[model samples]
Target: MGHPAEVEVLSKALSGIGVDEKSLVSILTQSHHEHKRTIKRGCSQFFVEDERHFERWNDDAIKTLKAEFKRFKALHFMK
Candidate 1:
């Protein structure tokens, strides 16, 4: 629960019908690695009960978007 507001925003963005890539990028790119780790931890702790529950939150579109974002981030960080 480092940045509660950010965790909330991310939860909202990731929970719904569409993925808010802008907000995700904004918070993630602006955050330090420690902050990102905290946010990730907070998300699982607060928003998601467990891995199975979290998987239920993802539809096909969200899954694809998530994978794409991961790829993009990896490439961006590599540069």
Candidate 2:
């Protein structure tokens, strides 16, 4: 899924008003662990820990969310 063409498909799926759920699900469900790892690694290169959406959250809530997201990244990323 890290291939240029696959990235293009995912970009399209994510950039629209509504996601193309079927395409996204098909790609993910068919992927092997290594393929999913490739996808994860590729994604981290572009992923940002944006906090703008959480501006309204209390500091503790925001901290918790960020901590959880960090843990998720560490657990799933192919280090």
The local distance difference test score of each candidate is: 0.70, 0.59
Q: For model 2, what is the error of residue 23's alpha carbon versus the real structure, in angstroms, after optimal superposition?
A: 0.8
TM-score of model number 1: 0.56
lDDT of 1 by residue, 22-79 (tens): 8877898899889988997766633333565543332554566677678667877999
In order, what is each prediction's RMSD in angstroms? 6.9, 12.3
List ranges where model 1 is wrong by over 4 Å. Answer: 45-64, 67-79
Kindly provide the TM-score of model 2 when superposed on the true structure, using C-alpha atoms.
Answer: 0.49
- For residues 14-76, could you state the per-residue lDDT of candidate 2 as single tens digits? 443545656667877888888876775554434444567422324553464456556656766
Q: List the residue pairs that clash in candidate 2.
A: none
Error of 2 at 5 (Å): 1.1
